[model samples]
Target: MNMAISSTPTSFSKSLKPSLPKARVFNLLKTPPNSHLRYTLNLKPPPPRLLFRIGNPKSKSQFKSHHSPIRSLFTGIVEEIGKVKQLGSDDDGGFTMTIHAKTVLEDVNLGDSISINGTCLTVTHFDTQLFEFTVGLSPETLRKTSLIELQMGSLVNLERALKPSTRMGGHFVQGHVDGTGEIVSTEPEGDSLWVKVKTTPELLKYIVPKGFIAVDGTSLTVVKVFDEEECFNFMLVAYTQQNVVIPLKKVGQKVNLEVDILGKYVERLLNNGVVNAIK
Candidate 1:
């Protein structure tokens, strides 16, 4: 089945300045910056206070009216790191999955965004303890990533859809794994290791020096880039604990890769005629 998604722009009204209490005003005047007491004594009384009316705070209803719900965001913990209970194809040629997650229902809702490994899937059903979600992988998504190789007890990271107020801690990620890359080599560099991975040519343009990239849902920065006849190779330098789990990555091990979303948008603008050109 084809998935159709849409997004709406968000807006905010100007915030009204709150009236300062008398104590606070006196404290400000006492500060060193306002030590010119003689000059202030000559000044006339403050102008008639104009009472600024403060409107009610924006509510979820207001947000819903102005924005699309599918674009909402959430983040959840990996409770039990449950395995793939079952996987099979449905009548419509779509894939069905029964993931038995422990503590999934503790905080997860019906439409939460759960990042299984690096791929985001939506919650379809749940009880008080566990929940089930489904991901309909396309032929291209299946061919490009290691989702098919997921076993019964694979550890996966989970995150809910993002809210407008949420601080973007990681680079913008769509939870869409673009392609699978093989680990080339890893060398210890002080407390960190410089990891090299072989990536596709199309993904190479976004892999810039010091640019951000996500491997298996973990955001990492690119340190260097190299090109060969077989593939474009790049090294990611990360700290010990952060780089260890993924560095043991075998020479030919396939890893889910998600290029920085911001990079992709910038590329689109450069190609579409928004900016004069990207320098």
Candidate 2:
């Protein structure tokens, strides 16, 4: 599995400023646990610049970042707000779901990739009248994500596959849920909310402070990590809290978690070189 990092200076500095070192790529392939990956990304020049104003007065519902990949990539940026219309066990002992969506349904087709709480699902059927789509969930998907907890009228985050022309904002999210986690607690820090989530040791092995984690399909940065507790903390800005459904979840509620794809790739590369790792 070859990983490539590319940036163009011609674009806005906020989109692709500074630059990443070639060595950082190599380090990711060999770094040990507890060692952080270091790279200089100057989306702009020497004197760093803030991409957006601290208080733009825009609706919190407005997603500030629009630059994401175009080719079936999800930056963990929730592009639309969808609601659960139906959820039940299929005849095959699987799960079938109907979700009503607005934005993502505009140009959707029969087999489009739609990220539902960070777990990618293929559209099986759709109703143009209600702007709804149906998806089938394998037993494995239920085991790995919190989608099983969904009920009718449950609001979920939704994002369409990346378009190649968009600018990458969040990070590469394959919509492959690595595991599920539970919210341990939430504390208010000024206007922001800090959430603590607890998971398993096997899953914690891949999380790192400052690393990216998708909580219920929204991309967030891990602020603090507790190895002994098998938990991590992330801050939710006012805008995020207002826009996503995560804040509405109770302390013990389960949430889907997708760790950074880059980390998983690096781990596989180190253990099996490349060919065998993917297998």
Backbone collision count in every prediction?
A: 5, 11
Clashing pairs in 1: 73-161, 73-162, 74-160, 74-161, 75-160
Every model's TM-score:
0.59, 0.70
Per-residue lDDT of candidate 2, residues 124-212 (tens digit): 77877778888766544544456645666778999988888877878888787777787889999999999999887878888999999
In candidate 1, what are the lDDT values of residues 1-279, reduced to their tens digit? 222211100100001012333232222112233222223223333222212211223211211111123354332222234456555433332334456665544677665665565666656545554455444333233344555444444445545556688777666666677666667676775665666777777887678777777676666667777755334334444532342235544555556777776788888897898897544
- Model 1, stretches more than 4 Å misplaced? 1-82, 100-105, 127-136, 189-191, 229-249, 277-279
Candidate 2, residue 191: lDDT: 92
Once fitted onto the true fold, the runs of candidate 2 whose alpha carbons sit more than 4 angstroms away are: 1-71, 91-93, 273-279
Worst 10 residues of 1 by lDDT: 8-17
Residue 14, candidate 1: C-alpha displacement in angstroms: 57
Clashes of 2: 11
Which 10 consecutive positions of candidate 2 have the poorest summed lDDT?
Answer: 1-10
